[model samples]
Target chain A: MLTPLFEAVRPIPAIALVPVAILLFPADEQGIVFITFAAAFFPIMVSTRHAVRALPTLWEDAVRTLGGGRRHVLWHVVLPGILPGVFGGLSVGMGVSWICVISAEMISGELGVGYRTWMSYTIVDYPAVIVGMLTIGLLGWLTSAAVELAGRRVTRWLPRAEEAS
Target chain B: MTLGITLESLSLGYARGPVLNGIDLTIRPGEVLVIVGASGSGKSTLLRALAGLLPAHGGRALAGDEEITGASRERAMVFQDDGLLPWRTVRRNVELPLRLRGLPRGERKAVAREWLARVGLEGHEDRLPRELSGGMRQRVQLARALAGAPRAVLMDEPFGALDAQTRAGMQALLLDVLRDTRATVVFVTHDVDEALLLADRVVVLGHGGIRTIVDVPGPRDPAADRTALRAQILEEL
Candidate 1:
């Protein structure tokens, strides 16, 4: 909702939001931080809810029979059960946040890879913009990959694809 | 033994549906009681009521002076399937109840190993439930129930799913475990041979309540004395 409104004005793309951010909040780096947070929040929320809902009833009953109180069951059994889903959500959210931050800087106001990319574009410096994009892609890929790896490690109880083979 | 169970006007069913109606029964401590019934006659419901897993919706279950309105740690249940945690190794699964009870690590592992060894699962501790044969997983479930050190164990068709030979072996193994531990056991099964093999008293559930709770004076060896006892329980069924 907020993104389309921010994007309506023409000369600046969303990416330019970073550079002018310093002057708007000169004492603290609040604006850029808030923008990054907004980009990653929703996907993480939805994925985690999906993970929690998918846990088997038997697992929950087993925990209860073992004398786990509500809190213990939620933290130890429920949380671990849904971790892969939550991590998947977080990874997607984080990757999108980084990708859009660069794009936001390029299109909108001031500092960040996006702003630098747009500046290069204005000067007809295509290679610099390409470099900005490659950097964003690499960072996003690495972070998402790291999250997926962590999820696999945590859900080691599940049957692995190799083992099934 | 001082422990005994009684249910007074115990009526149990789902929110609206009926399973048991105005039922009353008594089980002596260290006694092996088997409940037999037709399909959906509530033999399993009786076990659940006995274990305190079933709410009255209408009736009351009492273990001596204590009321069992919900599941209690003092009783453990073994279902038809091995209810082993797929994620944990056999040893870890057995150790779970102890860990939940706040038992220290060294002691919990030691107790877990002893119970595993007793159930003939000594070397299979590190193996996950899926890696083991069905019989082995059932033994692990048995070990888990025993490891909790419950005063009574509730079994709902514990060996009903196994093949004939495996079922016989599991029956023998279960009797050995029960005899060794002397825990009061409430077993629910439609299998007459199984009931004759393990139970000291066979309680048939029909006509809404305990049709009969018969005492069988036979040798503990099911494989040995089963010919006569099996016929008797079959007649009762």
Candidate 2:
């Protein structure tokens, strides 16, 4: 049911929303942040939805027959079932968020990596643009890694690295 | 004490139409009843109806005199797929029922350990379900179902996917466990050999209500002088 909405939202490039964001938001900063959130939200939603939809129907039946009600099943089964995929989505979402946010900033913003890159280009400051690009890349990598690390910690019951493969 | 179940004019199916029509039978407490049939014969449908999974079509199932409105702890089901939560360890999966029932953690752990051992998964307690072989995973599922000490265990082709040797081993393990516990079992399978080995009374389901319910005499071995019985069942199917 929610799938079609997600489908419609998933494919359109976040950069396509530049005009819409500029018109909707009162300030460039807020507009960029909204774009960043939009970019992140769709990937997470789409990935998590697929994860949930792909779960075996029998697993829910198993819980029900064991005297688990709907709430019980959600907590003990559904949430745990989707965590790995959800975290995977989070990792991807973080990367895309950076992309959209920087693009929005470059289009129209006083500061941020994207704006800095654009300003450097205007002044022909090639080295400063490179540094901004590098910093953005580092931040994105660190955030994604943090999410992956958290996923590993919580899902410790999963088989270890070698056994998983 | 184990619980007996009665079904009266039970019709079951999906939204399109009824797959199983007019299933009326009583499973005695502590009895091992195996239902056998070809595909689309509604054997699995009947099992699901009894498990309170299939919504009421024309009639209802009763646990003793009480109508089975929905799933309850009295009836636990073992699915064809080993429905182990991938995120939990084998021991934790077995402990799930106890945890749901709000048992004290220590007692739940002990019971989980005992049942895991019974299923020959003693040392593999901490391992996740993904790490286990298909046969071992099925064993863990069985242990989890039985650990609840439920009155009835409804199994739908729990060993159908295993290799012949592994299927035989699992069948033997199930029989051993069933013999030791008081839980009544309604095992569904397409394999005639499996039905004969496990059933005290083998029920062949087809054309709606039970096609036939045959009482197997002592020595429930497929290799025994059961050619006559096998022929009779095959003929019915």
Candidate 3:
């Protein structure tokens, strides 16, 4: 039921919706936050749906035969089975959120790395703009790395075949 | 305690059509009854019905006096592909049924460990399913199934994917384990030799029904000459 709506909204770039976000929200911060959330939500939702669908029926059968009900199957089989895929989405979502948040900040009024960088560029402060750009890059890399680290911790059971070699 | 499964005019199949029709059989308590047949002969279907994984198209299946309507912990199933959860450690996988049964964490851990030891998977308990060899994974599956102490075990070609040497070792391990428990076993295999070796009675299924039920004579000896019996089962297939 929600697929058609999601599909329609998914193709519209979050960055492209800044004007609409400004119209909808009372504050620039709220608009920026909304765009960031929108940018992250789609990838995570899509990956989670695909992950749930791709899970093998055998695992559910195994759980059921062991006297597990629907709740047990959800806890033991479905949730863990989709962790890897969900994490994949989360990592991608983090990166996309960074892109949108930075872009939104640059386009709107406020204080952030993107706003600072834009301000420095307008003022022709080359060194300050470079510093602001570096700060944004560092922040993006750190957030992505944090998400990936958390993903690795929860999905430790996954075989790192390439790493083994 | 072991369970005696009764199939009274049980018919099983998917939505398309019936696969096994009007099947009637009584599996005695504590007996290893192996069902053998060619591919698509409904051996696995019959096993699935016994496990309550598949519903009967007609009539009823009974475990003792209770009608088999759905899956229960009383009838555990082992599959050709080891169904151990990929994310769980070997010990945790074996402890799954116990967890489902609402056993306390301490008791679940103890029972899971004991069963892991029984299946010779002691040192590998902490490892995930993907880390284990095929044979090792199957061992973990066996431990997981038997750890629940189900009254009956319904196996659908559980060892069919293993190589000859590993299969033989698994067979020996299974025989050893069977001697210790009274769980009624309904094993489905395409190999006639496997049926003869493991079964107290072999049911040959063909043409959507039981073709013949052969009683394997004597003390379940592997060394005994049975060329004639082998030929008889092969001919039925």
Candidate 4:
């Protein structure tokens, strides 16, 4: 859903929430973590649901006729069928969490990439802010790309996104 | 132990309307009844109704003396589409009916392998349905339907999709198996030749219902002179 797209880019949006969090949560790290968790939850849940709904009826019928009950079918068939979708959602959620964590730190309180970036900004040290942003970008990309790779390996049955396109 | 079918004004169809209207028919022990009709004429629907796969719109069906309105576990069906689960191996496909019946795993495996061998798929037990050829899949379906030792076997054009040569071979195999099992068979097909070759009595079903149940002469043989009989049935149609 729209949640995944927004959460994946949450770090960029977290900068904007700095003023509001500072007013609401008394300048603390707890508020920053709270914001980060909020940014990742929705996307993961929605994508997993979509994947679960898209499985073929033939799979269920085949299992049932082959002597599998409802529980066996759900776990063995439905779970594996939707694992790729769940991984996709999870990757988005993780990327967003890292982004929001850094942004929350730099703008609202002490700690995280956002906090250090803001400190550098106050001292007019453009290099430090640039370094923080570059570090966050590189780390986020590596983590998300790792997730995508793992997803592909797990779902070798699914066609590659580029090839399918 | 004789297999018999009794239907009292059985009506069958989907949500829209009845595919086969209220009609009475009986399949006696060791008898093969071929229900012939054109496509969409509810030939398959009638077969499915007999198998208890499709619910009746009206009336009832009894296998031997037990009613088929509920789960009878006495009837097995081979769908026209070969309804083999793509994920299952040939052996497992044959074992499915037994598994559904709640037999132990060891017994299921032994019986499944026995039936798979009977269908000439002994070495291909582990091969998935997708890996098998069309004829092979159809044979697997037959093995699955017959493995449970059902009282009646309903086949909806089991060989309808196969090549001519393969279809003929499958028909011969089926006749051989039927002779051994003596299971009451309700074979639905559009081919007059197939109906004539396999059925003890060929029922030519036109647009409305079964027009006539023609008592075929002598034991059916495809190589025999059935041309005159075919023409006679066509005239009746």
Best by TM-score: 3
Which regions of candidate 1 are displaced past 4 Å? Answer: A1-29, A107-111, B224-237
lDDT of 1 by residue, B1-237 (tens): 325788788888887588788888777888898888888888887886776666775667787679886666677788776577777889999998898889999999999999999999988989888888888888988898889888888888878788889988888898878777888888999988677777889888886777777777768765565576566556655
DockQ pick, better of 1 and 4:
1
- Residue-by-residue lDDT tens digits, candidate 2, A70-106: 9989999899888877987888998898888888888
- Model 1 TM-score relative to the real fold: 0.85
- Predicted structure 1: clash tally: 23
lDDT of 3 by residue, A52-100 (tens): 9999989998999888999999999999999999999999999999999
* Regions of candidate 3 where Cα sits further than 4 Å from its true position: none
- For each candidate, what is chain B's TM-score? 0.93, 0.97, 0.98, 0.93
Off by over 4 Å in 4: A1-165, B70-72
Clashing pairs in 4: A105-A114, A105-A115, A106-A114, A106-A115
Candidate no. 3 TM-score: 0.96
Better of 2 and 4 by DockQ: 2
Better of 1 and 2 by lDDT: 2
Q: lDDT, candidate 4, residue B128? A: 71
Candidate 2 Cα errors over 4 Å, as ranges: A1-30, A148-165, B219-223
Better candidate by lDDT, 2 or 3: 3
